[model samples]
Target chain A: MVSELSPTPGARSVSADTEGPRPPMPVKMVIAGGFGVGKTTTVGAISEIEPLTTEASITSVAAGIDDLSHTPEKMTTTVAMDFGCVTLDPTLKLYLFGTPGQERFGFMWDDLVEGALGGLVIVDTRRLDDCYAAVDYFEHREIPFAVAVNAFDGKVEHDLNDVRWALDVGDHVPLTVFDARERGSVRDALLVVLEHALATAQQ
Target chain B: MTVGGGVTKAGTTREVKGEDEMTAGEPSAADDAWGVEHPPSIVRPFLLTAGRIAGGDSLVPTIPIETQVVATDLGLATLDAFVFDQHRDIITICRQPQSLAEIAAKLRMHLNVIRVLADDLRADGQLALYAPQAESARDATVLRRVIDGLRAIPDSRGAIRER
Candidate 1:
């Protein structure tokens, strides 16, 4: 009865892996809005690389919602978040995460917004409701954010002030209009959120 | 601002603007790789992780999709140090620093699957994670660096950009 021998004799002396070309520091900001509010488009316009989707599937909810019948019933839907990275410098990387703003996906936001710098809530004037979840989430958490009304075809259905009033945000939130398709427009929109962050941090 | 709810809707946004020009759907892709019919993916994570996948655990300490992981040379040298094939596969992919999302995409597995597996190796000190800032209050210094990075982008649009 010979015992199973070790795969490698005394090969587990793993050394410290902290030398040379350390992995760059990663910082993230979320681009959140309801489906079709141009979260991915906003990421693509300014991302150095194409946006990538990570389908983080959640299986089964807490009791009452969890059906004990079948595997299909127990397994929940896949929560995908598209993200893109910008190499800020050799030592730093900034990630732009396009997250779903639907209420069903709220469970994942705590993890998503953790350590986030801020957020940008993209709005569609015709369907302001699409972005309301995003606006409320950021506000409730007091996470600095800016709301940008994405003017489809360069036309805003509602006036800027009207949208602001409808959102009922304080003077602190920066609300603006930007085109999701234009690279420069998206950049400016992000800057607006960062400006809010800077102001918040300075206080 | 996401409102709270108990409804359990799922599926990442149906599309990511214009990305992932893959030839086909995920279910079929896994089948093709195996060269044999495979069961639905809803069950694969359970089988692969022996029911220890990230979301399945109430306290697995999940990392963000953007978190970068790389293989330590010692882990690479002692390949058998890893317990499962997934661990080895992840270390192979991490020779060059890769985000969890990239590794998941490359392996054609769900992101949470990779999260748990990678974290296992990371916990063993077989891999190093260059993590984002922990859940904490946003700091002015980081925000200032982010602003500077955004400004560094070559203004592709016209001149006289508004500040």
Candidate 2:
């Protein structure tokens, strides 16, 4: 008889009753960038709750993938990851995860990147090269992403075109300028990522 | 299941992996007891998962769901004192649906640690993880809703808010 009941088609369900408060469908987006590029700040701006940090011990499973040039043969490196959430509706929620762009931390990115809608690779114009690793990883993995040049103090030293050329991201990628400090800007930037995610999903 | 064998009960600190039912150690007195004090900051993070570098890829369980969960009769029967505190906290908040990130934030524990604890509870049927049947990794409708929701948020401009 358990099999006789109709199951929900998309998400995995544990119980069958439909009238009570159900768990919201959890969807996530990633904010990837170099250190101090404001990934955490972007997540914090629009999150319903203050962002939280978690320490994860990333092991050597990523020896070949992560750029280990800085620390060779190191068995493990622990990093503090910041994340926040937005409730889109009673049944849908959006989670924003900020990831460190350092290649050594690429292994941990798997846990965050998988099943995510898309990514916003925040770039600091002053350090144009810092975001190269993120752009490479997201491009190679085929994850839909947008390059948001985070202008600190409402100031961008370089042209967005120059930053884009320096990163050498493909033409298909969406490159836009934004300030990470404002909630509205963060939300709009995420909207762009979601649009890209929607396009990819439909295809 | 018994918990805690080579445990050193020095103050409020104890190793959770040493007490997990899946781990090999035998159950001792402290295995089922709850620590009344906070664990010292010096305790290694891996000790919470019994020295396992990877806590398994079960982030799916942390997905927010609406199924109601009452703590199993077994409850915190075999949890270490510190783990029990977290377990009770989850049970109290989960009376209604909550996301894994919410639980972690409210409890002030690392998300990974909360993941391990939530998995433990699910394994024992002490917690029920309900995921929305209509949602998936790349659902078009869901993505659209997210985009709409983000757009609906009120605009913030002209002032630099402190983060």
Candidate 3:
């Protein structure tokens, strides 16, 4: 004989177990750009903590094994990233992660983006193509993101419109120029990313 | 049938076969070789803890639950919504059952601080203590499953699902 065991109508499933309220964790954002575009500086400016950086000296053994041409002048490399925190409100916190500014470190991007709210793509006007790798990565991943042009000294100058045209950024994407070293500018760039993330999440 | 050991056919009696007689000795032989022994019984116990932390507030412990410990223990930290915009480093390290002094030494934290956190975690049900060595294996399996589930969730920007 077939025995059928079924719950009565309107019976709640055991899956609805977590009904109580809990405090939320802070949101996370990543600062990404090409080599020496000021991703670390931007994160350090706004971070409340003594920015934790995992920079181990590139040893001679790693000289032949790893590519050091783009990173020769640098004494320390962000093997993982630099982490810092900022309080946005009484109930929310924002965590900033500065990713290594080289295309070869693309493998680490996926882990950095996990659970992150979104990112600010820091670009330098001198080398517009420098930001292309990050842009492409974010686009392919369908991650909500915004681009901020870092105005480096003696760098090639370009207006926001020209930069947008060169990057071929779509109309929905937000683009702006800012001094990465300034706190207010960095905060504004972050706000743009968060706003975009919120808008996209709503959609 | 003849008395003692004999087989009887209809209207006739004869000596029993050697095979039938040998079969009767098997039970005696088994009893002589090994006496009966009962299997050992074991019992296991465990505890579970959970807690919540408000923005700018320290982690607060909740009530603890007692149950059968299943495997090795695990610790996890979940960030709040407000802090999601900022980046922070969070690392979890496990300490085997030990005194507050030992734990502090291993983690390089002050003894008093470790005690405070441990007590809070224990009360909140976030920290779990298991009993009976067998439970360790089970706990390891459960912790692995939990980690796998967390990793399976998509974490990219704009990938968060609405409540």
- Top candidate (lDDT): 1
lDDT of 2 by residue, B34-141 (tens): 122333334443444443222333323333312223343344343334354556787667666666655654565655666656655665556655544333547787
Ranking by DockQ: 2, 1, 3
Cα lDDT of model 3 by residue, B26-135, tens digit: 11211111122222112100011112111111233211111111111222333231121111111133322222222332333322233334443433333332211122
Residue range with the least summed lDDT across 10 consecutive positions in model 2 chain A: A1-10
Candidate 2 structure quality by residue, lDDT tens digits, A51-147: 7654433344343465556655434333455677888776577878777445444454565566677899998888876777678778877888999
TM-score of 2: 0.73
Best by DockQ: 2
* Backbone Cα, N, C clashes tallied per candidate: 7, 10, 40
lDDT of 1 by residue, A70-158 (tens): 32334344555666788888657778887744544333365567677889998888888777667777887788999998887899888
After superposing candidate 1 on the true structure, give the runs of residues whose Cα lies further than 4 Å from its correct spot: A1-16, A57-76, A103-108, B1-43, B55-57, B79-85, B135-137, B158-163
Whichever of 1 and 3 has more lDDT, that candidate is 1
Worst 10 residues of 1 chain A by lDDT: A6-15
C-alpha lDDT of residue B92 in model 2: 67
What TM-score would you give candidate 1 relative to the actual structure?
0.75
TM-score of every prediction relative to native: 0.75, 0.73, 0.45
Is 1 or 3 the stronger prediction by TM-score? 1
Model 3 chain B: which ten-residue window has the lowest total lDDT?
Answer: B62-71
Candidate 1 lDDT for residue A86? 85
